[model samples]
Target: MTAADQPPQGGRGPRRAVAAAERTRQPTEVRRRLIVDAAVPLIAERGYASVGVRDVAAAAGVSVGTVTYHFGSVQEVLSEAMVLHIERYYTALSEAAEHATTAAEALRLLVDALFTEDTDRHWRMWFEYWHAGEQGTDEAFARGQADRYAAWHRQIRALAERGVGDGEFSCDDLDGFTTRFAALADGLALQRLRQAPPLTTQEARHHLNRFIERELTPRSPL
Candidate 1:
């Protein structure tokens, strides 16, 4: 055998060591997710603009090089965090909606879910994204915000269409109704976040229910 191919005198060769290390190392995708999970909560607690790779690395219990190796840049990390946050929020909404018997009930459940203490951090993160978009500091974040709103619009529109099919709503224009509902919900959420005589959870629910009642016929109890 060639000298280079020969095993070391006292221990495994460098190639064998490397192969063993690779076998024991976490998968690339798992490592990436670990970094992302660590980064997101920090970004939620402190705005994305305030977080750095070192902070993420420390939180993830990995070296800065590991974070850099998984995510090319801080912006990419922030983007991935935003995506994960949205996914969680969407899943919660979907679960709430699934338990409702009517579209109106689903909408009410969704609003309730949005205003809970658990969702407060998410809302804070969401507002940070909005602020970043307005300042033109991060184009990717801005685009992501727009995409999230579009998704919200589509979801609301589907619910409104279902309500119409059930003969619960009087609206002929589902699109307009969906847009108005989303705008109202966003306005209320912003007011709550500002906490300037912050809208109480019950008050927000009352207003949303009132609006729905105005638009939809009351379903008779069976």
Candidate 2:
């Protein structure tokens, strides 16, 4: 019989009570979120290679068996945590970029949002992801990274297309513009994170804004 099906042994009152309490504990979804929440920060701080199922179980105040049962393996748990992190990051970016009066404004808001302290942990996790990919230690993580980058490019391209259609900006080559814009933003973020030449958040944002202004010509009013 499974552990859940096993009855209290030795006919002890305390043992039976404990078993009943375990049965009535939070539902699976709640417990799974607890484990993922616990893993996110640990993975961000320690990197995936340094953390394990036991660490996540301890952080979530659950048993190792519970973590294993919910996620099946340490890699699964880490993957879910990274997915959660990326989802939240993308949501924030989308919200910030939406409803902007112009594409230039949207791009500026995105750049500013990326450099904030609120996103520092997410950026750290992203770097950890990149390191894993570079080492060829985690194929799943590398694939996830590629997918996220593609999603980012799609979002940026949509913004560029919107700008052109609205006559707020002019770009002869949307594909080339999107590629260069994304590469510049990523390079700036990595430089800021590494403190190479020590760029302030404002400076980085300003640099991006200038690049946008230079690359996209404002449409002449009819």
Candidate 3:
């Protein structure tokens, strides 16, 4: 092997040695997932630019070869990490809305969950992947991003229809409103992702809530 790819000689790189044994003991699929999971926080904290395969391997408690064995390159691993992380985000939004009887309550739960401290890492990870994939060189990443956007738009449209049914929201053009709202949320999320960002999470939610009140929610009778 090339000197650059050589495993760390003396010290365990980032994670503990005891966990190394457990990391390798799992089935192939499980080990692959472990590597993806390790990459997410590393990407979130370090940014995709700074994190290398070696960093991921150390974090995953696996040898560099093990990570390469499962994923051909670091980009592939990071891409999968984005996929898994985003899937959980969508699932969380669904779960948050499940308890809400009114359309307004469902929206409040989704917006609250979307911009929380816990989800800050998630937004970071997403922006990192988005920056990397925006050039369209990564075909798989491009396709996945398109699919994810479509899914998000669908959810927004569904909620808008439900709002109409519950008499909580009204919009002359549901499709146009859905697009505008999705873009608004995306902009707010990017603002929140900035380092030392001026936009606080609460402020992001407040802006979104305000949009709902003005654009979607029906005003009281005069």
Highest lDDT against the true fold, candidate: 3
User: Candidate 3: where is the Cα deviation over 4 Å?
Assistant: 1-25, 195-197, 219-222
Model 2 weakest 10-residue run by lDDT? 15-24
| TM-score to true structure, per model | 0.80, 0.82, 0.84
- Model 1 lDDT vs. the true structure? 0.77
lDDT by residue for model 1 (83-147), tens: 78877888779777878898888888877877766776887777766665676566766777888
lDDT of 3 by residue, 1-222 (tens): 997677776656434556666666789999999899999888889888888999999898778989999998888998898788888889879877877898788888888988888888888887886787874488778998989988988887878788887777777888987898888988898888774458888999999889888878584555
What overall lDDT, based on C-alpha atoms, would model 2 receive against the true structure? 0.81
Total clashes for model 1: 0
Best-to-worst lDDT order: 3, 2, 1
Candidate 2 ranges with C-alpha deviation above 4 Å: 1-25, 135-143
Clashing pairs in 3: none
